[model samples]
Target: MFTRLGVGVFIWVAASAAVADPVLQQPIDCTLGETCEIQQFMDHDPEQGEQDFACGAASYDGHKGTDFRINVPDMDKGVAVLAAADGVVAGLRDAMTDRRVVLAEDQTAVAGKECGNGVVLRHGDGWETQYCHMKLGSLVVTKGQKVTAGQKLGEVGLSGKTQFPHLHLSVRKDGVPVDPFAPDRDGQTCAYDAQHTLWAKAFAKGFIYQPGKVIDIGLADRGPDLADVVDGRWSDFVADPNAPLVVYGLAVNGLAGDQMQLVLTGPDGEVVNVTQDRLGKRQAQWFAFAGKRPPQGGWTAGDYDLTVRVLRDGKLLHERKSQVQLTR
Candidate 1:
């Protein structure tokens, strides 16, 4: 039975020699780095270690697919998953419940169905693409149905062996897992080569590799929680003058020794600025926040700006800014 280790980490067979490459399109219908982010990539390292196509630790060991993740609020609104290439649907599943696998029992429930409600397409020449973690009952294609590139197959979801909502896209050649970013095994260098990529010209240019990324940032009335951030609840929160003004940032692929800094500035001047402790080890996801309670007059009604930055070796790696209005 197929099994997953962590967030979308799955097993794969050995890769085969190169074959005809499939000209792929963006599989998710959302603005990259805005409504969605590429949280993980296919593991390029063949050993127990993990590495993305850019030689970064964004991928987990044995990860067989590239994970295109969306914030939970966006998932709730529905984000379509598109076919990456012209193909015939080989198989599909749509009955699984849309829920994250966080506990041991949840893992057992999805044991062999680690791909969740997914669709498999055969693009001929021994090339095939599998789209996993689709929302339950959102599949629009059926077995043997012909689909064109960019056609909607389903919506991304928190299903099967995943801890978050994402579309896990896997490319296989002759039933062997292949990295679409680095299709040719011979050209598996850390640097991206347009000649070796499967993405179409337009899409290839947008899939820039990043070692770290700030996925979300927001201003809240109180300290933010990881669950609340993942659920995207902070986006709707309204702050009053009497409440504490907090700013939180959510990031992915935080390497060891990385530090996160949060700063808030009011109409008057700087309010709160704090740098979190260095991460002791690699973290798939990291959350940090800083804030201050209301002053004697209750925070002066005005506009507040929050700046969040991730630093590695004292060098800025990623930064995000957000603004919120405080009313009396």
Candidate 2:
């Protein structure tokens, strides 16, 4: 199984000889907070709790890698995974099929191959980097071949024990996992220490710590299915003037007590507005929608606007606005 290091103290005692740190570039070819986002980070907690470098619950217990995630639709189009630094290919695996693990049988099938279709690169000075969950048959570099930083390695995939499509980048020194965000800090402390990050200057300057944000929003002719939304089926949806109008929003990392609201406005005036009850507990991913059937004489043509907002403690956390055109 592709298990990670268990919770324990991480003290960086000085070595007799100093090792050069491996400076890293962005591993995925996508804009952060737009086409892709950081789904998770390496856990920094020393005990049984979970804490990301930003002191947020954006990570799970024992997570040893940073996850760069693109939505399913983007995955279908293919997103390239780049080498974080120049190194020799240490090893690779590319025979696994691309599929999500949703059943017990599926989990059993990927027991020892949890990091399906991955590559390991060995940098000098005991530094190494591993890229996991790449698409099968998409690898461009061969084992033992030298690769340059930012070289295209493969496309992201939904293989292994993943529930979503993402590229997991794990950094290591002397076979021990390291958090690129705060590599020198003690495991018990969690905070954004930009000066200690391994990310290249450009990427580090633009990085932002997002605890929760909306991923998708759209207007549909009828209530849209969650699967359809996730698959980008509603990306190009057009509504008929006489059909019902539904506005839906998808968000990630929603905390307990957060409130989601949806407002729809037609050319004529306000059509529907709703504020859902506070969430009972933390949600990794959640969706909220509001809509209404056409009026007595059918809806007015032109443009309809939908606004979605996430609120916590009566303050706005995130907001998205979308518009759809209705034709006769």
Best by lDDT: 1
Instruction: Point out where model 1 deviates above 4 Å.
Output: 1-19, 185-188
User: In model 2, what is the error at residue 32, expressed in angstroms?
Assistant: 1.2
lDDT of 2 at 39: 79
TM-score of 1: 0.92
Mark the 10 consecutive residues where model 1 has the least summed lDDT: 1-10
TM-score for all models, in order of appearance: 0.92, 0.89
Model 2 lDDT per residue over 134-210, tens place: 88888888888999999999999987778788999988888777888877665455557566688888888788777
Q: Which lDDT tens digits does candidate 1 get at residues 1-328?
A: 2222124334444444345568889999999888889999988777798988778898998988899999888898899999999999988888889998888999999987888888889999988989999999899987889999999998999877888999999888877778887766453456887666888888787666778988888888787789988998888988888888888999999999999999999987898899999999999999998888888888888898988999999999988887888878
For each predicted model, how many residue pairs clash, with residues at least 3 apart or on different chains?
Answer: 0, 0
What are the runs in model 2 whose C-alpha is more than 4 Å off? 1-19, 187-191
